[model samples]
Target chain A: MKKDKLVIGGHEFQSRFILGSGKFSLEMTNAVIQNGGVEMATLALRRANVGGEGNILDYMPENITLLPNTSGARTAEEAVRIARLARELGCGDFVKIEVIHDSKYLMPDNYETIKATEILAKEGFIVMPYMYPDLNVARSLESAGAAAIMPLGAPIGSNRGLLTKDFIKMLIDEIDLPIIVDAGIGRPSQACEAMELGVDAVMANTAVATAKDVPLMATAFRLAIEAGRSAYLAGLGRVLESKGEASSPLTGFLQD
Target chain B: METKMDHMVYLDYMEQVDSDIMERVLDTVEQYDYNTYIVEDVKAALCKDKLDIDDFGALLSPAAMPFLEEMAQRAQKETRAHFGNAVSLFTPLYIANYCENNCIYCGFNCKNKIHRGKLSMEEMEKELQSISKTGLRDILLLTGESRHQSDVKYIGEAVKLATKYFALVGIEIYPLNTDEYAFLHECGADYVCVYQETYNTDKYEEMHLSGPKRIYPYRFYAQERALKGGMRGVAFGALLGLGDFRKDAFATGLHAFYVQRKYPQGEISFSPPRLRPFINNAEENPKDVHETQLLQVMLAYRLFMPYAGITISTRERAGFRDNVIGMCATRISAGVKVSVGGHEEEAKGDEQFEISDDRSVAEVLSSIESLGLQPVFLDYIRV
Candidate 1:
């Protein structure tokens, strides 16, 4: 059997879990990655200061890929500038475009995300835009040359888990690009359910950082994701609509 | 012998302004070349189904002035999508007019020799009862900046009294510490409105020469402290004409944006009050914030933040107020009496500023209905 791999921007990643490093210390993040078998990590541009004291890059493992995000940008121009800066810092070409103007809900500006994605992708950068789970916006992002479309399960840091499951499923069904669920997945079970629904990957931050044992929580998420992927590959069974059928044969062995 | 004013507890509550966010706002405003935007850019911004910060800038630029009709149409559509043809109506009740601050533009400044009165509990209840009879459910309690005359406890008592008559109680008074706001919130205050007055710090210092209000950093973070105190909503604004109106408006929006981001559960609102001449001083007027520009700012705010509550106060004219009922303004002040003890009795103190719309509550309600919008007095019920 061929091993299924999560591929984004021509890069292959054996681990499907994408760790978010906003609230966690760099050492904690490294520990979590090692325990959870993570291959990619998202770091805010502010935290990726190269020569600054206690730079986050110093504590990262060699095998992990850095995905720098434009966390503070409220406009498309600002997001483009941040993406260029991230590349200059040797963070490679992977950039997560997160343009937010609605600060109350911290909702992603889908219009701005599409704009930023188009500009960065044209500049030879792998643009993975974090966005609201809207099918129309997802299609626009794909057309804008996004490496992958990252739809949010809920608001950032909200551990509410997969509130947009139906919408994301629509994207997975309709869009040709990889569908990565980002933000709002608070539990391993939720991540498993998303995988079962055929999402390419899950990105989480607050769930692990808020856990009592960070690395342990990361491991739990890892096991759940793998189990889900295996189940999906084996094919989920049909669900009975109304009544339950008995496992034993109703037709006679001897009497009938 | 130690009085509450002597403690000045809010002095300890002053926090250093978040310099990063401030720098971002200042830099964006300083570097914004609105002139570089052409009609093509404005058209592009208008044509987009979804607008971003850049689009908002384009809409605010002079190039977009020729496209006012288009901007207003889109703004109205956005407002309808979020608010659903409902205009919230409330009235302001000035409980005290004894200000200690020496602001150069206000009527109630301590330097003015006008009547200064703080409502007694009896007078306040009478006023509340009188306004409550108008079928209005939201009341905003305001006072001039005088801690010695109107202490936190007095404000808390007024809030407690107001909660008895009104379903929603908001306060627009001197900024308070977190604990003070919490105490008022415990007294049933749901909203706190503090105008930054102007975002230009130098102009702010020059205008407010003396008093605790002179502490720029303290006033800048009042809404945050109020939210920290567990208030449900906070309103923000920049008094137009004190500085560059465009930059002030932009800063006000960004301030509300960032604060609401941190406190997503808190309801956010904007009250863009223009400068009106104070009592006995009718010569002062807003420098360049004309009606068209004011409408532009309001429309820009609506397109940028559709869900925010934008209050068009009585400072604007009655006809103008009527024209803007359902356009982009979601909230309107009706039957306002800005003098202490003026609603139910003879005026005891001078008015804060001249109110152009002296229409009765019933009149405002009719105007809202005439415009085919619902007049909402209370949208949410307390638990």
Candidate 2:
């Protein structure tokens, strides 16, 4: 029942989902990630330890590759610096560039993100730009040499649960790179819906972080993502607009 | 066509109008099938036939209070249907208690010899941290009417400071110009609440003898200014015991009605704060309003503007507040301490006003749940 291989940035992930490292104790976060069966997790560089004993890196499992994120950086320059720091701190090669200019909404600055992605790709880093679900922006990011494109289902930490469904579906249909739906997912059902739309992966924190039971919610998300992916691969049943008669009178009429 | 009556003339005529006319308006509102029809007809019916003061009188009369209960109940059901079974909770954080105003009702009057306290940036942070522990995501920043000590710049800084902890931030400070209001909104203020205190021109002048608040029309038109400033919502309220409750109530409703009509996109809320017992000579306070009357006022507000949010603060008793929540009230202040630096521990020696409902946020949530209503912590998302 578990078909959990997903490819991003030319690297294979045994798990189809990624978890965020914020708003959870290290022990509880580790328990949730381990329980959820995630292969990789994203950690914010701002929240990471700098010459400290108990950094996020110290708590995470050795096998779990750290995908450092530029969460607080609001411009291309700041994001690049954060990415460099993460690379220096041994999180090599890959960076999740989140240059959000809108402080109120935390919406990614598409202009800054593209500019940063171009520079980072030139610098030999596998850059995944967190962008709006706009097809044009996603295509631009891809052209700018981004390894993958992250589109928000809704605003960050809003728990609004897939507000951009139609746009996300369109992005999934159009983009060649892996589409990772990030942010605004409140429940496992939303995650499942995103996965069913054929997004390559989902990254979440607040849904599990703020839940009454974090590890249990993590497991629920894992199961939901698997079920949705399976349903997608097996092909969904056709939806009927109206109920059809059990016996077709038209067939008898045709024979007569 | 309804005759155009001056605001004061209309209020005076309202006292002498017949009760039967009020009954007709109520019946007309009830019999109307469509919401648009009711909205149009109710306003038309009340204002029709030479601005029948009788209908206004009847709607507010004691006889109408019982019938108004039905309207309030309907409004409550609609409020519950739209907003769900939850009371939106928020706390008002008083930044500086220094007032240049000489408003007669307040404890923080400049002339009064009470211990005045103001929080510096560091103190304000401590207050924010203390309030954040209550699990409250909405806050209203309040201040005294000191233009020099606590001006727009000071308030804007406070609003910015508040955004770090709260998802929604509002102000209940002095009125500002449109540009100043816009500046505060840019600093992340979601709402602005400025009570006209009393709308009766003569009483308004007498009560606010000194300070910038004494400027009557300027304060009266502040909500309009706030709307122009790009605020998402504005709250209107009147000090219940300051003047004749009926006249004041009528004016308050009219103010809200005009603003709502003017700014259809903005959200409007109404609060009816009765004068609570102050420290000096509580006995000699001749203008104390009754609880039943307060309930009647709240019920009337709900009946008048069914969509407007009715908020009850900690000025009321726990039993009365508990009862009103199910009736017509939709928002409340819980675990409230009105004094400066109150949340850090027991309020510092100097406090503003005495808070009635002293229950913690957890206790308030449980109490609300016991009444079969859900306690929603976060309802609004920026997206």
Candidate 3:
């Protein structure tokens, strides 16, 4: 069998699960990453600062790729500067452009995200823009050279799974890039459902971080995502339009 | 109804108040067009698994009234998803009923000829002892909007007294400065409840008439100040009948939404108290807010902010409280007495307003258990 891989910006990843490190404690970061079988992890640059509580980089394993996010950037210029700073700080060229100005909902500004994606992609960065699931905006981001478009399943940290299901489905059907669902995925079943819907990858943070056991929840997400990806690959069964179909041949029954 | 000197005081307080939040709320209220929503829009709003602000508006509109059953089911599912079957119980102890405001609707209005009183520290402790004996760990301390009679020092002392008996002490008194709220929080107040009586400033001005409460912006910012004071939680409410019920309800949800966003760690709750008849206004009922409408508002709030704590107070009837608790409400006020210092002895003053469900704590607990829900007294403990 041919091995499947999630390709973003010409980089291959065996793990389709992208772990968010924003909410996890530094002590648990490595365990959660290893338990979840994560090959890629996103971190805020501030958490990696040398003088902070403790540098998150020290806990990261050698095989993991760090996808630094521009979390505090409210405009395209600010996002670009943060991306450059992340690169200068020895983090890789991979950047998640999160240009958010709406303080209430923490909603991403697709316009600013597109601008930042263009600027960062031009500077030879693997740019991924977290966006609202709007088709036209997704197209613009693709045109602006975003490697993968990460659309929110719900508001950030809402633990609401696939509230934007219909729009995200439209993106999956139309957008010609890896459609990685991000944010608000609370339970393993939700992540599995997203994977079954054929999303290329899933990014989760709060759901696992706030769990009763962080590492256990991380493993649950990993298994669910893998099961979902396998199921998607296997091709899900069809549903009846009206009535139930018998599994054991109704006409072949002895009573019949 | 107000004197020239009262107008002078109102103007003086107005000068000292910040109006940025009020302006934002009023702008939202003025621009909200509930009438523009159609049945299709409401249907579309209800179809989504999770709701946004526009969907919230549609659910609160008249177009959504016919789909009340559907809304209730969705609200129930959201409630069960977020809060499970655990309903927290708390009782409000009115520590004082003295007011410097001339708000015409309230029984405790200074101009009203109602008996006024403030609880002494010993009296407050006795009341707290009586309440604490009921196995109720959460207690909210309320006072009429009067700083002169019930100052910050007196409220702080009452809070300090409450902390000794109750595990969680909350304040629903007059709006205080950030420093004053800090003082009360330092005295062990865990939460603050401030109802911006009405968000419509014009209606607010006409209704408030006079007093420091007439300073709209100061009261609007009370919850933010309370959060800044290091309180763990803050509750938002609006007297439902004071203005347009739907818009007022929307503004209440939006206010809490913004505050919760600014302080992500802060706990937010909602208490949608209708305009019950007070002493001066015995004939008054909620202008347009009936039971179904109030339920709709609460369901909308639950769908909008699933994590928020919605307190169904004893202001509603017993049956309504029971029905809504399983549907959307996460908290209830049991064994309530609005009069100042009434738990351990005879009433010391007139009650703040009438209460409909006068069920005792044990009865309320039994009722909650019968509905297959757990009645929690204290969900969080202060170290």
What docking class should model 3 receive? incorrect
Q: Lowest-scoring 10 consecutive residues by lDDT in candidate 1 chain A?
A: A46-55
lDDT for position A254 in model 1: 78
Which lDDT tens digits does candidate 1 get at residues A1-256?
8879888999999888999875543457678998889999987775443442235677788888999898767679989998898898789999999887554567899999999999999999999999999999999999999999999998776677999999999999999888999988889999999999999988987777656687899999999888878888889999986758777886757764
**TM-score of chain A, all candidates:** 0.93, 0.92, 0.93
Listed for each candidate, the true contacts retained, as a fraction, are 0.05, 0.00, 0.01
- Residue lDDT tens for model 3, B186-302: 999989999987887778877887778887777788888888887878999889988998999989988988788777757889999999987767788779889999998999998
lDDT tens digits, residue span A1-256, model 3: 9999999999999999999875545567788998899999997764453332235666778889999998867678888988898898888989998877553467899999999999999999999999999999999999999999999999887788999999999999999899999987989999999999999999998788767688999999999999999999999999786767656776675773
TM-score of each: 0.61, 0.55, 0.63
TM-score of chain B of each: 0.94, 0.83, 0.95
- Give the Cα lDDT of each candidate: 0.83, 0.73, 0.84
DockQ of 1: 0.03
RMSD of each: 20.7, 11.4, 13.1
